[model samples]
Target: MSAGGRGGVRATLSGLTTRGRSFLAAGIAAAVCAYVLGQDDLLRVGLLLAALPLLCAAVLHRTRHRVTAERGLAPARVPATGEARVRLRVDNVSRLPTGLLMLQDRVPYVLGPRPRFVLDRVEPGGHREVSYRVRSDLRGRYRLGPLQVRLSDPFGMCELTRSFSAYDTLTVLPRVEPLPPVRFGGEALGHGDGRQRSLALAGEDDVIPRGYRHGDDLRRVHWRSTAKHGELMVRREEQPRRSRCTVLLDTRAAAYEGAGPGSAFEWAVSGAASVVAHLLERGFSVRLLTDFGVTVSGEGGSGHERAAAAALMMDTLAVIDHSDGADLAGAYDVLRDGHDGLLVAFLGDLDGGQAASVARMRRRGGAVAFVLDPDAWTREPTAVPEPNAPLPQRLRVLREGGWTALGVPRGASLEELWRQADRERPGPAALSGKARG
Candidate 1:
């Protein structure tokens, strides 16, 4: 049977508490014998005694006569460490008034303890509204329902309980911060290149003509000018060239060893946020990919920019499992084929096999930058006889394989690392000349 059905049975039996049932049986026996023996006074007394328990049950039931419940201010989606409001409405449908009603609503264990709400008195056909502001400090989905309503008699001899199924679900997303500025090695530091190139409009070059290229906006074609020149020409508009950069936030737990109080995943998220913000501020089209199966493609305009920022913040709170590293490979493959931007990966210490995979990405004609945090390998003091070597040696191996690798110390501020990255990135002039080379 359903819980509500069982609760209904319990409510019916609760009226016959041990004492109540005894008192009822005694009254019935006395009243029947008195009536047969023609004892009017005894019969009257027995009937009066029986009325007590019956009246008590009636009063208990009457108070809970009208009940209406509804959820209030339930957010469609909430972030971890955020709060949501749940509202319950109780209405008195009977002509009598109710006093001191107790209610308990079932909530997920992850949501902590179940809360109780009290209603002083509800007049006949009157309504009472109660609300609880619940806070979720963890990430995941929570189910709420099966409200329990209990009403007590004024004399406190018996209680009436009812159960209802009011199931609702809430999804909690991860809480993230604004993406900060980060630097990565590759083509021009602040110039746009690759698929979507940015051009600066100077007075001397209001409408310079360039050879037609694939993916160029057809609207930008200078039809009159093309006719005059007897060839197709595209209009050149001026905007600061934005570098193309991609950030990979590793979600592997194996990297968290010896990391600070927070998990390595948290640190990686923070690093990715910093890098994305830094690149976006410098006019670099930034894309973010996470091993948690989250992706935000590169966007150019201000609105798209805001979306990317929001995605970064949400990603921080995302739940990730490091059970299999295969997901990392899958995410990397998606990024490799779809994005032509400079690649920056923030990972835990790398193994030989993993280092080979990193090298494979670099060979695909993209500037690859790796930030390896040593904390992952140093969880236990005994785990690192030469813990420090793994990071530097891994970088050397990657560099030898033609990938740009940077070793970031555990606990180092993202701002400092970002500056170091900037120093290592090739300047626009340098890249232009490199193309010639």
Candidate 2:
């Protein structure tokens, strides 16, 4: 017998329905009673009662079932608080007709409950299609799939569950808002030490072939190019200049307050997303950096490279979570290693160490920070003075270290914040002048 037929037999034997079990128990009891009392009538009734289950088991044992499923998503990727429609198509590929079948498409709890349906029957070589909608306010990659179909006997005496091991991934990206162009002071950024240049040079080099230089290896000659140019042309190992922007998002859980979408961490993530989008749109190679110094997305190239990089960055931001393990200062050490055109940070209330790290990043390029007031986001108001105390002290430290720092409320709009940072002065004076009352 075929594997599917053997599987069906095994499933029929193992998956005895409630009614089937009850009938079998009644048959056994009746048979025992009839044997003890020498009653032929009871024995005949027991045999009749037991015949239904035996027939069901035998029918299922010989049945073979096979199905194929395909799943499609209307929009596979979406922003936070977006919805998508999932369409499922199931096809019966067996020669025998399938009995009553139930279908369930599993989904993540964040999206919604699993969608379930019941079908009376699917004829041989027949098909059925179903669709459902899923929505989530949270951001992350979700799997929608592995169609579970339960095949049962006509009388519901036995059931066999078969899983179609197919899955589709839906990526829920972070909410990216538009930001006004903000200028970074022309501090001499590290020239030609960009991530893209290094990666392109070592891994996938995209270069032109020029005339062979002194002591150039014969193997380095581009034969095709040499033939075209009618001269010995060797691959040029020059680093092309591409503007770089590093967006630092603070992810230390202790640094932010509140929970869920309205939390300071989420605000920072949104702000970072906006900054990343704005930079990439302006033709700057952007890299997303976290307090843990994790490089979620590295510098992008022009055109398709930039677009792919931006998409990956937005997807990365969707699932970014706060980390409390890495020291803020230690993480900032990554900033000193490379030169970036612009360093924009979305930060929460910072301690002295964290503030000092921000200061260190100023040397890399034009450092600008959008610092959020954590106390305002908390349930209970803190005693620390907002404008006259802690916020001002932190701003002073960052400004003194040569950073343009803007203090923002938890509920401030990122666009407005970016515009203000663009026109505002650097240092504690800017905070005092633009500090919200």
What are the lDDT scores of the predictions, listed in order? 0.63, 0.74
Off by over 4 Å in 2: 1-11, 26-48, 61-64, 185-240, 296-300, 380-389, 425-437
**Maximum-lDDT candidate:** 2
lDDT of 1: 0.63
Candidate 1 per-residue C-alpha lDDT over 1-437 given as tens digits, one digit per residue, 9 for 90 to 100: 01233334346556555666766777898899898999999898888777777777766654544565555557846766788888888777767777567889888866768979877777777877887876676555677777787776555556677776666777666544443344344444546444443454454345777867888999889777788789888887645545567677776666555332255555665566556655565656777776554667655446677566645444443444353454368655766575555777877667777776665554222354546555533455455445455667777666655555677654556666555665665555544444344
lDDT of 2: 0.74
Cα lDDT, model 2, residue 87: 86
Return the TM-score for candidate 1, rounded to 2 decimals.
Answer: 0.66
lDDT by residue for model 2 (1-437), tens? 11232364455777779998888889888988999999999999888778878777776555434666678898999888888999877676778777787889889998999999888777888988889999887778899877787777898887766676778888887778876655564312223443333323543235577798889989777777888889998876556565677888888877787777767788888889878877777767777888777886655555787688888898889878878754566456787776646778888878777687677676545678888877667745454455555877888888877677888875778888777776664644443343321
Which pairs of residues have clashing backbones in candidate 2?
none
Q: Clash totals for all models, in order?
A: 18, 0
